[model samples]
Target: MSRRGWTLFLAMSLIWGLPYLLIKVAVADLAPVVVVFGRCAVGAALLLPWTVATGQLRPALRRWRPLLAFTVLEMTGPWLLLAYAEQSLSSSLTGLLVAAVPFVAALAARLTGDEDRLTRVRVAGMLLGLAGIVALLGLDIEGAQLLPLAAVALTVVGYATAPLVISHRLPDVSGVAASSIALFVTAVVYAPFALPRLDRLDDASGTAVLSVVVLGLVCTALALALFFALIREVGPQRALVITFLNPAVAVLLGVALLDEPFTLGLAIGLPVILLGCLLATWRSRPRGAMPVPAIDAAA
Candidate 1:
């Protein structure tokens, strides 16, 4: 990785990581739909114009079907579920649960015939990661936390599935355009639910309002743009290292700023999950095959 890659990696780690905390704060006052709507609206407002200026908007809109699937899978469902989950789960836990994405992506790739080989190391890693998930879940998988836990699992599936749609179905579409349209779709879908709750903001604290604004402008718009660039620069597989880093940042912020718990389960499970992610996503060299320099991991 170049200096730029490293810079983007760190920046994205924070950019993606902080959203957990922001969602936690935003949902303190705004409803889940409002948070999701505000995020997509702000993202669309910023990126749609960029997509047009870049002359990618037309091409992006032409692939409406796949793009819509991508949007619903990537942003609409996951973002709403994430916001809703944060209402009960700690920011740290939410971030860590999402760390399972690479494993899910790995499985999705294999299942979709995107990758032919699922090596022993990767399978082992998946098992290890699942053990970590079980460890984490054992701490809070009962009663009130059950629904949020399920929501996080589904959110992981959505996150894992969206990139596959891009790689398999919409590879030619501009990242900016795809993102812009996706935000537009999300905002439109959530408008009815959000509008009715708009009046509730009148009673929201300054912190809550600021959190939602940051969620939109920084987390949604800027983060996605940077994420696409990171994928371009480092390749999608390596770009995912951001996933390992984010939980750490989220945990720190959750503990320091929000005073959320640093639970025993997290301490035991997080490193295990990161290790599993590293192993599962690792590319092995075949002795007879020609050397292929590492590029982006296949989407």
Candidate 2:
């Protein structure tokens, strides 16, 4: 990778990885809906200049159905699930769970014939990934809250479903426009649920507000810009190395910031999942630079 490309890769990784920590902060008092809503609204607002400046608005506006479907599947559905999951899980742990996304995408691809040949190694990777999740979440009925765990499970499905949506339904749309419109749809849908709490929101810590704002603008908006740039300079395969780095960063933040518990589950589960994801996504085929669209990878 060129120096410029290396910079973009690191920047994008930090931007994406830091969100788990920030989301934990943002949801400290706010409901998951509020947190999701705020992030989406802020992201949409921040994204406007680019869409308007580039004159993509009219063209995008014309493609409303598929665009809105992208919003529903990629943005709104997946995000709310993440926020709900964070109520029980820390940012770092959530990051680790999200690492399973690539494997999920692989499975979805096989089912859909997007990448039809699923080898034994890939199947092994998926099983390992599932085992990791089961171990991490645990089977002890007494120790767990079913709702939160279910929320995380839903987040996993959302992650898996996302790649299918983009790959099949919205492939030609500009990534920036796609991301921004999705955020806009998320904001619009979550508004009614969040607005009643706006006045109550002022009492929350300044730290939380800062976390949300930074997450919306920097973690998402800035990170996405860098993601596209990195794909261009280094190509997608190398730039995709950042995805492997995110779970580690999340674990660090969970330990350092939230003082979340370190369990045997995380210790054993994280590595298993990461290794599985690595094998599942590792390809021998030739490549061109393309963004690692995690939202789309949710499938």
- Residues 117-220 of candidate 2: C-alpha lDDT, one tens digit per residue: 45666567666755765565554444446776676666666656654565556554566776777788789889999989888687888988888788788776
**Model 1 global lDDT (CA atoms, 0 to 1):** 0.77
Q: What RMSD, rounded to one decimal, does every model reach? A: 4.2, 5.5
Q: What total of clashing residue pairs does each candidate reach?
A: 1, 10
How close is every model to the real structure, measured as TM-score?
0.81, 0.74
Over 1-299, each residue of candidate 1 has an lDDT whose tens digit, in order, gives: 56777777779988888898788989988899999999899889998988888788888788999999999888999999999999999775677678778777767777777543568886787667656655543534344578898999999999877876766677567777788889998999999989998998889998898998898899888887777666666445556656666766676666688687878866887677667656655557644654222232211
Per-model lDDT: 0.77, 0.65
Off by over 4 Å in 1: 1-7, 116-118, 121-138, 232-241, 255-281, 286-299
Model 1 compared with the native: what TM-score? Answer: 0.81
C-alpha positional error of residue 75 in candidate 1 after TM-score superposition, expressed in Å: 0.8
Location of the lowest summed lDDT over 10 successive residues in candidate 1: 290-299
